[model samples]
Target: MKDTGWIAATEFVRHPSMVGSAFPASARMVRRMLAPLDWSNIKTLVEYGPGSGRFTFEMLRRMRPDAQLIAIETSQAFVAKLREQCDDPRLVVVEGSARDVRRHIAAETCGRADCILTGLPFSTLGDAEADIIMHETALALKPTAVLAAYQMRTAIGPLIDRNFAQVRRDFEWCNIPPCHLYWATGPFKAPKTARLHLISSR
Candidate 1:
């Protein structure tokens, strides 16, 4: 079997639109993206395009024991590799497009995700496709949930801004090519039944 790096490189060569980046995210990049998360309170987590499981491993290590992680990957090779490498019951690797996140989440879990992390390169994706994925992601997340993503280019920043009520930007230069991190919340309306006091308390 080929190693993860080799597999990732091959996948990128074959499907540049899908893979996006030339390399998987560095450990430092993954750490920075996850730094603001409250692992103890996260019950359901969703990951889009978890190529080679770099960030997946870090997320699993830090998340609560009883928490569940749903990794949605369109590449069969990457999906198979993740299943083989990770044996944790908390993980469920699904082979599908990020645009259909809502369906996958509904089939795999009962609750809306507490957070959605992505490595999807909107720069490589067509505007329509990226819009659908972003819209679906917004719908899949709980009202207070977050969306975190890292990209080598800032072309996707405007699209993210349109989808979320608030956006925070950060950068990490330790990675090979460096990347910009975007943290976003809301733009999705809260349930009518949701109490203002409870929402304000969190």
Candidate 2:
């Protein structure tokens, strides 16, 4: 496996808005973010912003042999590098935006996802983009499906809370700039007017 630490660092320097973080998650933080999942039951998983595929490979390792993971990423460099480095039959690398998560999930699973995880920087994406991603995520999941996201702050928590009935917040101080990890479940269909109200209020 190729080491992506330097690749990720270069992308972060070139595009802070796109990369979200300066480094891939530490092994300890990755463990905590994933500890909430029932790995045995995750048949279809989706990951947003899988920079250099740090979390992608780990999830693929723990998933069932027949399970699939769809990794959606926006950075061209990361996407190309991931496709080059990963040969896992179960992994589908999509070069796209998380705002269109529903389409990506449908194209692969043809059903609801068992779990979705993200390292997206919602804080920099504005309320509207975050709302859209959250809403689309709900539409793409089965009931009680998990959405695990780590951000630099809790501002994204309210947006996530609006889409899911249950949301738990954890802090991982071992990471660069620290991280606010949210494990959310039981997605609710977002009201048609929710996004407009939230965006306009800000």
Candidate 3:
């Protein structure tokens, strides 16, 4: 893959348009975000909004050859572009929104996802839409699954806190705009739930 060319194309890729360039996450960033996932415990991994196969490629590089990778994307052009770049047997590129993750992976009794990586432009989504995505995310994850998302907006931390347990800020200086990474596990529990209520719903 011509890494330089791919990054350049992200500038004009259409579909769910955003100001930030598609600028795929760097190898270092991918490693850092996925560092918490125990490789030995993972079998099926899902990448939400894998634009241009940046993080997808990194996942391919790290996982075992037999591990299944399901990439859910909304852009047809990006889906096509990603298909062209990804020819690995372990990877499965599905052209659709992250909201459809449950439907796509439901048939596989053995394909329970252990980790979910999201790059959706959450800041642009309305509360309802974001809620649906979060709801689906919770359903798609296993009992101990982890959700790692990148938000360019610092104020989006509360949104993450609402849907996830053990929510914590992970990274913010990796990208050009310095994204804030939100890391959480499964769903919020009792103690955290009460604390969650204490947080101002700004």
Candidate 4:
């Protein structure tokens, strides 16, 4: 999509809770966070809080031509901007809360998602809400579906661990606050590791 960085930054100031970061994630950071996914196997991708299509367009570029992407955003301004800027037949920008992702995913793909990309700030959310999103997200996805996410805080790791069995922790130091990144799968199963912290640097 066109450069929506400035628009994204402005939105963050107006809606910090919803936008999560002041800057649209660095291209490098987004690349590292998404590199683990096997793009060939991803037919249905769901993105939680795709602010201004940074990750949305990238995923679209990498996913199969016939695949679909459903992006759930709470901010109407962000949603409008995405809808206005992107015309790819593979993209679906929904103006709604990430908490209701299951409904959105079901409507778009009519099945469980192959992957879910999280961009929401769990640290800023209520305990109950964060727990619900994680649990429901696990249920909305295939048992072995991937949950690739990036956060400016580490608190979300344990919450994700509760629902996903295999969790791998990593970090990218090139972003706004030098955030934490995670790749989790094997939903609704016992976690093999409490936390595997690779903790890499830029």
Candidate 2 residues 10-82, lDDT tens each?
8889988767888888887888999889999999999999997778989988999999999999888888899
Model 4 per-residue lDDT tens digits across residues 1-202: 4357777878889978767788888899889988999999998999999887778888988989999999998887788889998899999999898889889887877779999999799988878889888877887888869999899998798888788878898889998878899999888833223223323321
- The segments of candidate 4 whose C-alpha lies over 4 angstroms from its true place after superposition are 1-3, 189-202
* Cα lDDT, all candidates: 0.87, 0.86, 0.71, 0.85
Q: Tell me the tens digit of each residue's lDDT in model 3 across 83-148.
A: 887689878888777887888777443545787888777777666677677767776878787888
Number of backbone collisions per candidate, in order? 0, 0, 0, 0
Top lDDT prediction, candidate number: 1
Worst 10 residues of 1 by lDDT: 187-196
Show model 1 residue runs off by greater than 4 Å: 189-202
Q: Which of the two, 2 or 3, has more lDDT?
A: 2
Which window of 10 residues has the lowest lDDT sum in candidate 2? 187-196
Clashing residue pairs in candidate 1 are none
Give one digit per residue, the lDDT tens place, for model 1 in 121-181.
8888988888778878888999889999998889778777767789999998988678999
Cα TM-score per model: 0.91, 0.91, 0.81, 0.89
